[model samples]
Target: MKKIILTLFTAIAVLALAACSSTSGASKDKEITLGATAGPYTDMVNKAIKPSLEKKGYKVKVVEFSDYIQPNLALSKGDLDANLFQHKVYMENFAKEKNLKLSEVVVVPTAPMGLYSNKFKSIEEIKEGSTLAIPNDPVNLARTLIMLKDAGLITIKEDTNQLTASEKDIKDNPKNLNFKPLEAAQLPRAVQSADVAAVPGNFALAAKMDLLDALQLENMPDTYRNRVVVNTKDLESAFAKDIKEVVESKEFEEVIDKEFKGFGKPEWMKK
Candidate 1:
């Protein structure tokens, strides 16, 4: 009876050890969830990032958001492991406002902003006093103004920092064009009603407006390129490192070239 009882206890101990070992393995392989907006950002992860990570035995989950605000919120709240939908300036401004500790993992390709007009086929055709729609947000409004300045439709004040310029900062409106500051998301629809609309690349892609159709486009500096961002704490983690590798890989460059044709320029090619 003593021998049989000792044998049963040993078997139970072995089973418990096995169960603990199995749980540990499962925890190590937990799927990582990344947040992004619905257009090219999501497409890049689903088409390129996912497969690349999966090949290395990691399962990646991509969560899509429509607006620009929520992905950062999600990442800050620990709902997402990382995100790839925002530019460096936008991310810095957002983190400062929200008091969130965040950092960039990599700078991916950029989707350059453009001036699109259905009413006028060319920038020269845009007449004086034409109501032009620009983004209401501070950073993007400034970006829009710079693009217009470059296109010679308007001139921004020489003293003002062009990156954050607002309608108040316009030094000259050559045609005396009317400026309508609307929500960035609404600019695509505004293109139909407004004589000229300045649209961000992502919003344009979401609205299916071809960049080639824009009368003028801005090939912005590297500071404006989209980034893969994570909570500052995770910047050195295995998952974050994998994400950086995947985004900077040749395969990802191909995705940018194929799916986003005229929209994104490869990071290496950035001036």
Candidate 2:
């Protein structure tokens, strides 16, 4: 029993030392790995952010993930130096839920959710009892609800926790809009059938729908805008600072205009 306990303690100590050593070696290198959800964001890092960093003497490698959770998990585990697929709300919530220390490096241009209709040509044309398709997931459902409220079609309850708000939190539906919650990817298709579909910005872009064509685009709050995220312990690191600087650069915004049109700029970028 004593020998088994001693051996387990020794193994644990060695693993801890290896983790620290790996982190120490990683922080000293000029090479950086940035994680993103596959598609536009991966392309954004490759086409826009990567070249700028390369010119400044850093080797920037981007890793693409198919899902939302892995990028942050990889970031927390130090497999990535930084990541760029999440909004501040997601980062804060994920960090709290997982008991991880993560912080935003900077907010970037985000595609805003848009209210679209195939039959009704305009917001004014939306009729009573028109069915609206919304994301079923809690956070995105909240976004859709908020956007609907902003469009003057609905009223969310006062003092409501809007981040997790659902159809039940709606105090009034002036248009008598019936919400059909669906997987986010299905929303673009919903516009063809449903009277109105509130599509989040990322999915709309994936479907190649023109954001400006929507009857209304979400006036996204700062918290909702996607941002660069890094581990909290690395907040003061040189590479982290460089990531913020690159996002703030004029070149980055120029790319946003040329390659990623219709994604709204963050407030910091607006200034």
Candidate 3:
């Protein structure tokens, strides 16, 4: 009798432990967390992707970050299931520098960089000695210089490439324009203070600044050059597949076209 009682107790305890484990697993299986930048990215996720995903039986939680770095960091640390905030080159550079184990699951949208100004109507109007604000970050500063060169405002050193260029890279300063290197996020605000500012499209849109007045805008490819990044382990998740589908779908394509106002297009929808 004593042996039977002990066996029964052991069986009950094991069953209870299994039940708790099963419940925990089910809870985890029900939800997926995605991180994105605060502007168009988040708006698209909320307005289009989230509703589509939820209808398909996923509990989708979209997290928004203002800065460029946090979404990737969160995805790497397992705080987020995925992130949609950077381009291929930026992701590769960040992974190489940080030794992070992340992969692109799907491409969503592309936000091109544009040269904006409150004071000047066009590149032709930018006076000599006018102050031009550019992002101070290495990659973006190079990009801005390229745009300025494209505008025929100044020239970059013949040998310099897209990945490397500095104020020192300027070969000809015909405008004698003063180049002010500032944080990427701060460039929009500087438009009010500077004579001209080179701002990323997303930031400019977020600030409600019009790109029609931009002296120049980069002609980026129409599609998802930037992507949704995920942990290597979660790459095959069903929720991830659903998220990708929603982003790549025609419904989302319409959203991108209407919301971004030609600054970007859905990667999946672009030829």
Candidate 4:
């Protein structure tokens, strides 16, 4: 009887140990995984958001992608808990096309697209028949065209909007300027090949392009602010809550102002 009791106690101890190990593994798996583009957005996450979130007892892991497409693809496929890479307009268009159920958690920052040129110091300096490079992607191509229109460099048809604009949309080209649409990632480098290039803020910074005084930026409205996004199904998850707190925190805002200057400030910060 003594031998049997001893054996039973040993079995119970082993089971308890296994249970504790399983629980610990489960807890570690609860850490939130976030994705962002590989520039100022990733920098902001590391410098401001991650430390604040750690203080709040949440594990935050940031994954960086080289270009725009992979982050959303990962989030939709359940590989990431959230992404901080795109504006609402872009997200809406992506969601509709891909049939993904992702939702924006909060507006983080706005990297207003700027038209930069090594050949010209100002818009007035751009000559007739000047060749310009724009982003080839549909959404960004439209955005670049709009910026050009805003700068009075070109004119689009009156009915055109952000959702739809093509080379065909150009109504007036006084200079008969050449429109060369390239990928967003390629725009900065293409500046050397063209008279002017419309480049996104993050990529411009990555290329060490001095856009502050070198180019003209489009006037972005409050509606175009970029955001942190997550799967709609997981909107109420702990990970989403943690990401929201990190993005909307004062620390994050301070870092944006200090590191990025005024180039990437969200409308909320302007208030």
Order of quality (lDDT): 2, 1, 4, 3
In model 1, state the lDDT of residue 36: 87
- Candidate 4 wrong stretches, greater than 4 Å: 1-30, 67-69, 96-98, 221-225
CA error at residue 184 for candidate 3, angstroms: 2.6
Report the lDDT tens digits of candidate 1 across residue range 13-78. 999999999987876766799888887888877986888888877768899998889999999999
Kindly list the per-residue Cα lDDT of model 2 for residues 134-244, writing each as its tens digit: 998998999888888888888999988867888789999988888898999899999999999999988898898999999999888888988888999999998889888
CA error at residue 170 for candidate 1, angstroms: 2.8
> How many steric overlaps are in each model, in order?
0, 0, 1, 0
For model 3, residues 203-248, the per-residue Cα lDDT tens digits are: 7878877766677887553221568888778789876777788877
lDDT by residue (tens digit), candidate 4, 1-271 = 9999999999999999999999888668667787888887888778877888788766788999988899999999888888887888779888999998888888876667898888898899999999998888887777778888889988999998766678889899888898887888899898888998889776788888765855788676545667889999988977777778777778877787777764656666667
Better of 1 and 3 by lDDT: 1
Full-model lDDT for every candidate: 0.86, 0.89, 0.79, 0.81
Best by TM-score: 2
Of candidates 4 and 1, the better by TM-score = 1
Candidate 1: where are CA atoms >4 Å away? 1-27
Candidate 3 residue pairs that clash: 224-267
